[model samples]
Target: MSKLIDPIASVEDDTKSPVSVPSSPKDSPRTPIVALKHKHEDKPLSRSSSLLDMLHLKDVHIPTPPAVKFAPLNVPRHRRLQTAVVATWAFMIPICLTVFYGSLIFSKWLRPLAVAYAIWFVLFDRAWVHRGGRRQEWIRRSAFWKNFAAYYPITTVKEADLPADGKYVFGYHPHGIISMGAACTFATESTGFSELFPGVVCHLLTLDANFWIPFYRDILMGMGLSSVSKRSCRSILKMGRSICIVIGGASESLYAYPGTNDLTLKKRLGFIKIAIREGASLVPVYGFGENDIYELLPNEKGTMTYRFQKWFQSTFGFTVPLFHGRSVFTYNYGLMPYRRPVTVVVGSPIAVKQIDKPTDEEVQAVHKEYIEALQALWDKYKDKYAKDRKSELKLVD
Candidate 1:
């Protein structure tokens, strides 16, 4: 009986034993000393297998640096000089004029002289509408004007030879932030406008308000830039002289973004009418890369910023472009335009019939033909000139 009891007790103990033993040596949760000894014994073989596997696998690629194409040259001096020249025209001149006027207020020697000049400009100076202030020979051939155009390295390409005695009206497109092309090609003969179209003088027209600024007015008059007023256009055309009008005024400059060809000219018929009335031949001038010189901040329609700009244009008769370009120290930031080429292509002239008072239909007909000519210019040279364009020519009013 005692032996039977002992056998039952041993069975109970076996039932109570833990069933936590690992099924295989490799499946063990913890590394025992015995497992370590076996692993060390197989280490040499494992390393040999790894080496063979590596030899059989694909090769790992190690990239090399690209080779330099061209050697660098000294461009900093020219770039800095170009920036200074541009800045002087855009900002320094205006600021300096203000300072000069303030000095006149404090100086007894210059006060009377400044006052007399101001009075003369307001009451007697006929440069705004008449050709009295244009010293064509001196202004066109001046070294200062030459340097101004050379800063951008601007060039004019004449598609066809304009008739020497032909009275003409040049309609400049894209009204770049400042219409630098118009200034270079027409305002100054720096791009050799006289040599290109001999005996065909062009007077570049701008806003009348521009002529109101002190000292700056004299500069504008020297460059032969008159007002875009009806009287000015009529007077210049009646004299058998050509006039270059930046038709896409200040409002168009808002769309003047880099890598874009947008013109606010769909509804602009005033210039067309002027051409018809004066019997002046219409010439379309397109400046490639004019808008690419600077970048304008985005001002989408309906946004507050856009509305404010529109309001400002309506109130002040002029608008501003929130624009920027490269710098002297870096190609990243500043007001200096990038060293991009500006090729002003002067298209073939479109002859307009003389109408003392052109009807809307007549004006529209001329405008349509002008637009077609402008489009042809873009289509012909876009690939060659504007290969980096983000979009094609769009007449966005």
Candidate 2:
């Protein structure tokens, strides 16, 4: 081996150049000074060029966000009428509740009666849990849901005609903020759900807490929306009514970003268990443009916002999505969801065997088939319906 040189000595040798140094004190003589050659001195660069090179600069393509096109300022009379009908729908529930509560406050006698009614509704009036609530075809075919569905101009296409006698548990994907497509297709006759499958009445399941609201519960019940609870699901399935479940729930609403198909379903097996337990056929329904309707705040993983949202879910049993969309006049900025086409596609049904207590392996087997069906639905329509998507379907946890 060659003799080792001291690092300090080598450094000193590198800076051994001498130059004359002027003395600061006028009385002192000039002294000899030492300077070092910079390591990159051979390659001379201008100040700006050197700074740019240090940054390792490269051209970045920042794509322009797509512009939201609104209906013409001078809308036709029919379209204006349609808008009014939609607005009425948006305000109907709130108006009814306000009037009901106002009556309770204004009338002293009504307070005690109202309190009694509430107690009865909470304790004994579980009538909302039955298939009878869903058989109200008159309400399901009403003008309100008709107008609401017509606002989006929603449509449904079945891969194959479902058997009228078969019981189904439809696992609706993406949750889509409020699951507008689920409401339009399953809860109402706007998309002609009845005509598509003649004798099968599909009840859209929601959180049991929704039925706690006074007038709103009646409205939901009238539209045949029952609780998403296991008991409610089993009861409905046993009664021969199909159940449409928003599988992603509130957690998936966090992933409802525009142009992205981020679903929170990889680890969800509760629906599969229910399907197997009730012997309900598992139907995978995908709503294209459901996530694209509203633009939500980015809740990236490990960020405080996402952590807080997850905590909120654990505490409150639901999540709040920070989302915004267009307004009546403006093209892009309001509470109203942007007028995007939401196509609810119903895929082929996966048959499940009824088991009193399904084993882990049995549940997983059904879940795998359900996931594959959902993926197939996505793959089939992604190009046709989601041509402007930013990314392909991501099965997020």
Candidate 3:
């Protein structure tokens, strides 16, 4: 049986001695990859040479890490105890709440509501701020979500018959709190999005407040994401072929708990108008399991959380999505909710004719078309994605 030996001990040669072998053109030969031997020399081979011989490979030595980079391992004696204390306290709230209400919140409807509370925040609960960090960098490649994929697993399905020829405006609906899956797949190319939709460049839009911050602003930019403003929409649609907006804004996220699909878009018509103005086709995408992943504290339409979010929005130009998910400790449950599989299904395209400044009648006409398109997508995929859905799609003001 071959036991694993520490290579460090055997290769700890302080001084690298010269051992002559097939040489460079100026000496003996060029190199193993591209070489012609001229002569050889006699010298003592080190243990590294023996290892190379066993591996049947030429010696292409690499240096060790610089010594100045590492300091002696020194940690406080109470460090482990401190970590244990912090972890216990962090898990205390969930444990208490689990024993208290986890049993009481069991009804079909009640259970869903509890689930909602777990995934959401009550306006003031977002732990971090989106300071408009780097977006373009995240959008490019090798992003945080790519690394995070190992934990928060997600899959993207883009199947709409998109024209490989023109620009498009994709309107994603029912933005569950933070729309984590959509944000990951659309905003970052890490989700294998580009490979799914060839020839199409997608830009996901977020709130302008996200861009107001320093680090977050760059993060957002690196992801090719921008504000969901008219200026942003118009510029993006005008710029190229693909841009997406989480059609259901903050209000949508608030109502995103499973079994209760309430949308606040009856009065929202800006996206439709932009579609008309830009003449880009409309593609509706719905992410199943988006709401099931997190249970949040209740924030009904008239609740304090809801009101606070509106106030925050009016004051700062953007509202915070009060949300939660699996805690760092628990794997199956917590304030953050469970890790559920989210499947985003892309629907057929709704072709639109571009207009510079459409009149009220023109906008309304396009709006009707948009509704049909949205309805078509819902009707086609409702059963496939929303197997346990409680009700049919509704268009309420």
Candidate whose lDDT is highest? 2
lDDT (Cα atoms) of all candidates against the true structure: 0.79, 0.80, 0.62
TM-score attained by model 2: 0.79
Question: In model 3, which regions exceed 4 Å deviation?
Answer: 1-139, 147-152, 320-323, 331-337
Which regions of candidate 2 are displaced past 4 Å?
Answer: 1-73, 91-93, 108-113, 130-134
Clashing pairs in 1: none
The sequence of per-residue lDDT tens digits that candidate 2 reaches over residues 207-233 is 877788777788888889988888888
Query: Order the candidates by lDDT, highest first — what do you get?
Result: 2, 1, 3
For model 1, the stretches where C-alpha displacement exceeds 4 angstroms are 1-77
Each model's backbone clash number = 0, 0, 50
- What lDDT score is found at residue 344 in candidate 1? 94
Global lDDT of model 1: 0.79
Tens-digit lDDT track for model 3 on 1-397?
2233334322424476444454555665455333222123233444354454434333344444222222124644343333343344335445545643654465665666655554453333232222222345434576345544323456777766565677877877777776767777787765687777777777888776555443344445767777677776776666664778887786676676665556666767788788878888878777766777666557777888989988887787556666555444444334444446677777778777888888988877777777777777677777887788877777544
Error of 1 at 2 (Å): 92
